[model samples]
Target chain A: MEFSLFNILDLLGTMAFAISGALAAMSRKLDLFGIFIIAFVTSIGGGTLRDVLIGNTPVNWMENTNYVYLIGVVTILTIIFRNKINYLKTSLFLFDTIGLGIFTITGVETGIQNDLDPIISIALGAMTGTFGGVIRDILCNEIPVLFRKEIYATASLTGALIFVLLDELQVNTDITYLVTALTVISIRLLVVKYKISLPFFTLDQKKSPN
Target chain B: MEFSLFNILDLLGTMAFAISGALAAMSRKLDLFGIFIIAFVTSIGGGTLRDVLIGNTPVNWMENTNYVYLIGVVTILTIIFRNKINYLKTSLFLFDTIGLGIFTITGVETGIQNDLDPIISIALGAMTGTFGGVIRDILCNEIPVLFRKEIYATASLTGALIFVLLDELQVNTDITYLVTALTVISIRLLVVKYKISLPFFTLDQKKSPN
Candidate 1:
């Protein structure tokens, strides 16, 4: 039951990320092939990076053709409905948030399975959640929004920590998943709604008069 | 004998890449930690990505402490002699070329070991030769120069094809390496010297008159 639930959420997350990628490509006015490539990379780049770092061979997408089909479907649908997607913006954002939460847990669990330290697990989790968007932004020729003082990676980091802490405390697995996911989703929504952001750090150029 | 020669060349390449990364960081006026992070990522990001894709666990740097020490020493030395290093730009470019050639071979050999197709091996080789710079450019908030029509990845690709073709023709391994490396270096130098470049592809802004 848990396995099926997680699988469904994973597919949904992939679809949402793919759609976002397609939209980015359209905004950039890329060709059809470019749009497909962008969509595919944006959806899988983060998980692929995390898997590679953890030594998970073949990466997740390579092991399954389902991801390819899903991305293709999402890209086509997005292109066809381009004129109407504005009304679905809020829904897309919600799906993306849910994706962030779920992907974070998946990364943390994979790290744990690999016997990594809890801190590293949390880091892997946050990376899994955030790096896809980073890759997406970079491919589109912009600084990653995550690095631009956004609350995005922070929410993933916080939720990852909470997940690790709860697991260490021996909380029920299902309950732990729920709370951790909720924490990430809530933080992201609240931050976006309120325009909350991390403080920017600039290196001061003035030298001390020693 | 061959192993030691390759090892020395690999170290030289690593050092050159690290220095280049530090130079980039210095140009950006990043903080000390930022400098180190950029240098490290720029030197190893490509190989790490390749290893993970091929299911090599622990990665090369993680398994060997020498890579870390090399990067550290290179980073410090580059920082110390930043001004004088400008005079050595030619030598640095030579080292980077050698590194690209060697890294391309390493990636190809790994792919072959894993029973991947020759075409895939060549792709992996090009990726290994080029993705570090891609990651570095992205992290530094610029579109990758490779994407800007530089003759970089093409050189790697051409060398990789030559390497695979020679191997298939039953050429000796050492000869294969030498020839492939020379091809990449020659192409890179010629391209830079003659200002050769691929045609830029831009999306047509206006609809075609029907």
Candidate 2:
């Protein structure tokens, strides 16, 4: 199938999410099926939630089984390199950050097609990028990185708003998409690089170490 | 709040699910927060998925914070009794069975209210009873019991179909609810009691003995 740049990005985003999930499974020392489950949920859980919210019948994964195959390969790769790739943590982080940015844009695009307002689109975009990881963490019985890690939904929110704002200013959709994706990835990567975090409600660091 | 018999049953059902989730967490040796997450999802995850499917906004648990506190208490109780309650496994199974049954009926009822066909209601009911565990298992990085344990959902499907059949025969709604709940609970308990399992698609266990 001839995929547009956006479609290609969507696949990349999915691959990234799946890899992150597989990495998490490796960390848990889970079995093969366990690795696949985490990868599948991490890659698709957010999009599935969004589809349900938008009343998309059959869901995207059910619509296209290719997604299933993609995640399958993702699990195999992570399993094969489980120990060797631990040192490539920086590269994995980059993949995850880039994937988050691309996925956020894809989510906003989905929301717009359904006629949601910009504010809602921004929120949906962030949800699309983040909730899968939250679900993954919850399954792994850990506090969600999105809930406690640095500048997560905030970065997606800003990028989504940027896309919406640029569109309102009559920018071409393709350019808007590219700009938003770059903006999101940059902000996320820079935050991680600099140990920057958004201000959030916290009782005390002693209370929650995660 | 005004409560009907079924409503009371619903509360118990929620408590049962919460307790099951808490116990699962306890078995895994999780901390207080992990137990809380398990209890919360086990209690509310199934219905939340159903509601989202039917386009109900804000979700059920989001509207009722009381249930959150209820799950909180249930989790604490599980934590406290973790060592002592291994002997009470049968009672716990009974509670889980009853909870699954009532939950099935409740989900089907909502689907019927939305004017979905009875077949869809049957599906909704099964989804309601099964999805929380699916979500729970997925988060815990395991293949959902649904994929491997056929009888787990078969009990729900049978009970849901029976509920529909009783309604078709103009059975009183109250009696119908009672019979359906009992039927599901009975089937589940009996299955577990007898070590009954569904034959695999190949009539051979697909899993490695390892």
Candidate 3:
């Protein structure tokens, strides 16, 4: 509301996530209504879920129509720019990473404000940063990328841990937020740049049908 | 909590939904943790979402551990009797329909108690009865059956509408709930038995790729 740096970052993140969602929906050949729905959910799903869990009534989007409007604009713009979207991939990825960082910190702060356990706070942070994309993937009928690929949630979790640790140490609030967000952004960028991934195992791999 | 008929029906619905979730997970060959997670979400996902939208915090499962224990037992039993599960399909279907009926009424009631608009209340009712299965299908990487198949949400919505209508007529509360639940259950059963389905269309079918 104050046009603060945090506010700007949050808007940017929301837009980036919306564009990503639009792209996914387009790939699936969803109709206009479906694309808007997907874009809206992908941008706000995590934050809405967090607010609901913490008993924040009406959820964030309902209380403030800015997010809804922003997502609407982004969805339309993405549709118009569909052909040139490939050229904007790098910038989109960067904005999405920034969103991941900021969302994770906000989620953690909300949890701490509610006096939730630190572990729960961390989970909230990671969920807030990642669950939107998870929902989007689910709606598109794909296994959530969170469960199968990327270091996405891990980055958010790491950032959340840093936030909790910094807050515990009574660090300056602005510095804590900056550091936490930077940490998440850096981790995600580096992981993708280097093709790094966590090890995965499937139990069904070794067992034959009974 | 009082072991009333509604309470019993609620528990049966929760258990039925949980088993359905567990069965879906096993079909995907997910690990035990994944199966439990799916089952847990499938049983409580709708009510939790409804509560969150209406600003009910700490959610239902957190308030009552009975639901948790019941789901746990259901999941274990489902796994143990996996090979024999086919024999129980009819029974499972019946319980699931009962759950659909009760959950719809409870959702509508919660919305009305919170002084929501009738339309919103009806939407809440349908969402509460159907979203758990929607979430389940998403987790299993399928388009929500509610969106693509069956008269699932339609039945819930119709039941919710009847509930609102009956309440307006100053019907007794118990009678209202009974009629609403039975209406939903009967509609679902009849729809399934008759192999009736809503017509669906995909936009891609008419338009060629650009």
Candidate 4:
């Protein structure tokens, strides 16, 4: 059933996101409580926002307490392997990208089920894929990388568009999901590998008046 | 009906929050687009989050576009009277506090209507009262004031608690709303007047091992 598939993917994404958040918190030298909070929000923030916006109350994680236990386990592991995890940046990146792919698909599909406009659906998908990290960076006292012309949101947006288009073309659901996720993961990897970015705007550099 | 009161308060709060957001953006020297975007988010971020969690979709601002116009107008006014407005800091603070009061009441009432737990309702109220500024601060690349042991969220929480308690005691709705809003506003003003702040902890100050 779709629920089982979503459950698996959601758990995987939560673990990956939790690890990323814990690392971020460690880097910032946050307290134990801060680390836990950051990890929880980073893992669930995007989906929480998406669910709220789509009128799904008591959100997914609120209904399923297991996600909390999973995040706790991930955070503890992250703390224990702090130094080792830092050295495994590439692995972390891959894990995070995988999460992004799965979350984007779920977000887009949820939007579709809610009968949202296609553009809004794609936006929801991109938001679900990226806003967790955005919240994470913000809590760490940094401008979100998403707003800094990073190729992050772009990758998710592209995947969401592809998924919508493929569905319109009568593609198989499984194949559509697979292709969309893979496309996002590939784009993310390529962007990072090539140092590719969107146009960078530094507003402070200009002296233009409003 | 409470609906009319909420509608008017909501509009006023939107304007105040929008102006505060515009001022923050201006202080950061963001471009016009950045100013507008920050203004929009700060005006609606908290309410949007609350509505989403309460299963309200398309969000209130999206459903009622007047909030957009109000923000746009507020942004333009802030830009045009930048220097003059900067000198009116006290007035701005009062306006922001008023918004916080009304938004808190609305948030708590919505939670009550949705049958959320009393504690959760209070939390939602505090979130509604403070999160617009939190999001604004984050977008401005600063640690949110809400997390910094300010007397901010505390004021909202106290008001929310009082509102819930009074409602449970079979208090008149009008008196409950007035008392709650006034309490929040009074606490905020007193806190500022007395330079009161909760104990602040900076994690980086510690050299504790993970």
lDDT per prediction? 0.76, 0.75, 0.79, 0.80
TM-score of each: 0.58, 0.58, 0.59, 0.58
| Segments of candidate 3 deviating more than 4 angstroms | A1-45, A57-112, A115-126, A136-143, A146-210, B1-12, B57-73, B87-95, B116-120, B147-149, B165-172, B196-210
Candidate number achieving the greatest TM-score relative to the actual structure: 3
Single-chain TM-score of chain A, each candidate: 0.87, 0.88, 0.86, 0.88
Which is better, 2 or 3, measured by lDDT?
A: 3
Cα DockQ of the candidate 4 complex? 0.13
Error of 1 at B186 (Å): 3.0
- lDDT by residue (B94-174, candidate 1, tens digit) is 656666777787777767767766766776788788777778777887666455434777788889999999989989888
The predicted structure with the larger DockQ, 2 or 4, is: 4
Q: What is the per-residue lDDT of model 3 for residues B128-193, given as tens digits with 9 covering 90 to 100?
A: 998888888877876676765457889899999999999889999899999999899888878877
> Any idea how many clashes model 3 has?
0
Error of 3 at A42 (Å): 5.9
Candidate 4 backbone collisions, by pair: A52-B52
Best by lDDT: 4
Expressed as tens digits, the lDDT of each residue in B1-210 for candidate 2 is 357775666677788888878776766777778989988888898878777777776777787776788888877887787777765546456556777888998877776777766766776788788777776667666655554432567778788899889888989999988888888888877877687765321111123221
Regions more than 4 Å wrong, model 2: A88-92, A199-210, B1-86, B90-130, B134-210
Query: Candidate 2 - CAPRI tier?
Result: incorrect
Worst window of 10 by summed lDDT in candidate 2 chain B: B201-210
Candidate 4, residue B146: CA error in Å?
Answer: 4.1
Candidates 1 and 3 compared by DockQ, better number: 3
What docking tier does model 4 reach?
incorrect
